[model samples]
Target: MNPTDAPFVPGVPAEHQPATGSAPGTPLALYFHHVHPDVRHYTALTPREFAEGMERVLAEFDPYRPDDLLAPSGPVRPDRPTVLVTFDDGYRDNLVHARPILRELGVRAVFFVCTGLLGQHSGQPREDYLTWDACDRLAEDGHLIAAHTRTHPHLDRLPPEQAQDEARASLADIAARYGPGPARLFAYPYGGIPAEPGLPGDVLAFGTVRSPAEPWHSAPQAIRRTYLPSGATGTWDGLVRHWRAQWQPAGATARPDDRDDLRGERP
Candidate 1:
């Protein structure tokens, strides 16, 4: 079916839609960047706002950890409202602000870090990203630490060989520091997926497609993800509308409506 014919949810990038053949109860993963009290960027969420939003989600859905959803030993329930929480770009706020809240809420999230940036300080407030020690601490706290690229770059804009090195190097970096388990998972910098799709080696990669991922979906390389907006009131409103669209009656057909919930945030 044409993706356009599928449901359109506000705040969600409509480039990818739920497929009819998708596995039942496939997870909807939400990606966040910064969770600082002072919102430096549009995608950053304040501490209070992040807590409240997560609480609301917990009320309606079951948390899907990497083990349960990514590489499950048991079969996933077809009717479960399963969701995975993910944070991109390793930031100190994730450990200081986001981690405590998530721990309190009993939700474990996946953190994708740029291997090269770990332990490097720029002396900028709220920009002194996570160190390797912090990443180890995060893992100790039961959260998964994955690779995001050696240095966050637009792989699409680089030569194929350089791009391949960037991707592979990061995975190797994480394995050397973190371990092989975490190294298996990777996310493209800026959610940019190359034409070839998945990375060269055995890795489950993610992209910013704003849709739920199926267990054995055809596009395994580009696992779709939705952004959890934490900017202005309008962005939150769009997120709420998208949540409603996602949880509508199973058989309900959505009216054809086209509105960009994350319009201004993107160039």
Candidate 2:
């Protein structure tokens, strides 16, 4: 079977439901780039490994609803641990592989897509990245579709007009292609969130990092996310061990002095 057409053996939800046993107090957002049967990028995780990671997460954390995070007036539930799974860069495998795992586990996730790059091939089969129809299917399936920028540019480095245009054009494109009710949630390209980050309009932007859900306390526009490390998917134990630390707060890692603009290897 083609990797994109891998069957969705939906895991048993009764067996994988989020346990009510976690001590609440923090929120975690996990961001992934790809999911394929075989490893490609260091960020790619196989379906089985992805499922294992989800199982480990379900065993401990409550699946935090994205609405609660996206809404400016949304409730911040710090009582018990909450988690939101997010996939960035509009990869096609996100719909093919990741969706089924989430569906079976009763997990709700946010998918950030680059509007300009959707429906285009990445030097190979067009299935390499998401298309408009696939994105629509995800929206229909109850997953959230948000913006990652129109061309996945380094927003901070662009001239002010171009930077704002990247932000504005993406939100407009997602609304035009998807639906039109503030598809304004965003993930900065390459996780570059300027220290003074804010779109001219209302938006909930995301930065790549591991931390407690303290975006509102600090930067409301740019939220923090825990990158799903490549090796964490090697085993269920690895998933549990690494992801658990990812759920809690930690000291900030070193950032480039020119942290305002981040460039990605692949747009």
Candidate 3:
């Protein structure tokens, strides 16, 4: 079976495993790309749709920032399960639309930026991406601004030296812009974990696992995140249809109007 398809077996090294009765609950990490009024990509979410999805997420899990896990003391054990919401490629709409909705909902998310691409416009207004000042404001707003390489290249395909520069320069750029603290967290561009491990040991890098509800063990250097779906399949209507099938009794037929979003409903 593919590693991405494999179940998340708990591999907490014996010495680091939680004490009896203090075992950690599953922590879901989700990554989104664009949040615009228009659906720019399948990963894009309109502001209204984004807000609704966040509400649904909150009903099931408490919010967590990336550093909450990267801290030396390990992640906090909240009363509920945790979810870390993150965005990649540093799109401008994240600050424009998503920020207001998240601010209203009291959730702080992580924004992984490519150092080289900031403020470079490609003629398309919406694709202008985030500026350095924008990223500074995001940091000031209490959102974690992390690294996503200097240029958004496939590290696995690049030459080793180039890969090293791409990975290292991103961290350096974050540190220079903000400070050393934010440099420790990273998300691989396009969810590709390079065959050559380019990042420093101290950096906690994240790649994505696409399947939902998979168990992701707490690996400090190699964290796994879920790709939050958007567009048609992201709406409540689309999700309810899929979830109803998953939650129904083994032989029970799902009714046509089994349309509940299942908020706060545990299976």
Choose the strongest candidate by TM-score: 1
Q: How accurate is candidate 3 locally (lDDT)?
A: 0.65
Candidate 1 weakest lDDT stretch, 10 residues? 258-267
Q: Write out the backbone clash pairs for model 3.
A: none
21, model 2: CA deviation in Å? 19
Candidate 2 lDDT (Cα, 0 to 1): 0.63
Give the Cα lDDT of each candidate.
Answer: 0.66, 0.63, 0.65
lDDT of 1 at 121: 74
lDDT string for model 3 (107-166, tens) is: 888899998999986546356689999988887878988899988998778888888889
Expressed as tens digits, the lDDT of each residue in 1-267 for candidate 2 is: 121221211332342211111111335667778878764654578898788777777776778776565444433444445677888889888887889888999888888988888888664422468888998898887788888888888876777677777877888887776655446577888776654454744466777652234534445465666544455343344444444544443553423232121111112
Window of ten residues with lowest summed lDDT in model 2: 258-267
Candidate 1 CA-lDDT value: 0.66
Give stretches of model 2 more than 4 Å off.
Answer: 1-26, 70-72, 75-78, 122-127, 177-182, 195-198, 210-215, 232-267
> Model 1: per-residue lDDT, tens digit, 35-86?
8877566357888888887776666667876654334222233244556788
TM-score of each: 0.77, 0.73, 0.74
